[model samples]
Target: MMSKEDKIYLELEDREFPFSYTDHDRKIVRAIVFDEEKKFYFVRIHRDDSFGKATLIETSGGGVEKGEDLETAIQRELKEELGAEVEILQEIGIVSDYYNHVHRHNINHYFLCKVRSFGEKNLMPYEIRDFHMESLKLSYEEAIREYEKCSNTKLGRLIAQREVPVLEEVKKMLLIN
Candidate 1:
């Protein structure tokens, strides 16, 4: 199995800090997805359920099902969330973090992909009803700004803290400011 320890970087005290942590329990795939016109796909999740906190903006992705390869899992996730077909450009990096909402450690595989086409979304019912998930296309800078805005609240900060490093990795690879 591919290990993510070599690729992990963490933040502490509001600064980028290099760190390494990995365990073999869960696999989630996150896409740093771009459209043909160069806009990135992002998900805005408005979680109003009993379990969730702030309305969150996040990159497009989901849990990888058992027996599915990473590539296939990403493809399925993109389609489900954004209703888009994507040509994966590269495996950007893996980010390790823990989600307080779920109280589980995450091993997230991040991929760079270009959207090939779009159609109707196929979101899970609770995701639609409770999370109120919505899809949006954003310029790289706009996406970063969304993160900044979400960081205002406590729960939002928890998610942003985990995602910002992955977003930074994407910016570094694409030279997006």
Candidate 2:
């Protein structure tokens, strides 16, 4: 069995809305992806609607599919988002956050992964037209700066709050500057 200290846990409130009900819980698998050269990989999403116009940087991940284990889910997510084959280096931890507007309680499972190769992305039609998703590769400092800069938006603030801590833990695990 794993010890408590082996992972970090976070509970985030819904800062955007004051809804008292969470109708559903979404179990997601995310990765802090890095290459042999030490560059990190993330997804940059551009939105221009109810959440407002903003470009947000976030880890690559999605909801865990039915009957899939966390490891399988993460590998599939990285492939779909980053278009890269990866080796999961470690399980970073879990972050439980609420999106009151959507009534979603997200239980995010984070992993540290090393890229093995890159290929074409299998992006969904909506991901292309709606989110305008693109891959971003940056050094540790650059990634942190991007996350901070993106925090100006409401959705961005929530994402930053959820992801930045996980990124910091990965940095410590990788011994990166």
Q: Which segments of model 2 are wrong by more than 4 Å? A: 1-5
Q: Pick the lDDT winner.
A: 2
Give the whole-model CA lDDT for all candidates, comma-separated.
0.76, 0.90
> Could you give candidate 1's per-residue lDDT for residues 1-177 as a string of tens digits?
133554544522322222344335478899988865668889998865544457788988889998999999999999989998999988877766664444456777888898888998899998888788899788878887998898766557766777777777777777765
Candidate 2: deviation at residue 125, Å? 0.7
- In order of appearance, the predictions have TM-scores of 0.82, 0.95
lDDT of 2 at 105: 95
User: Which ten residues in a row are the worst by lDDT in model 1?
Assistant: 11-20
Backbone clashes for every candidate come to: 0, 0
lDDT of 2 at 18: 72
Candidate 2 C-alpha lDDT tens digits along 1-177: 133578978888878767888889999999999998899999999989776889999999999989999999998888898899999988888899988878899999888899999998998898999999999999999999999999888898999999998888888888996
Q: Give the TM-score of candidate 2.
A: 0.95
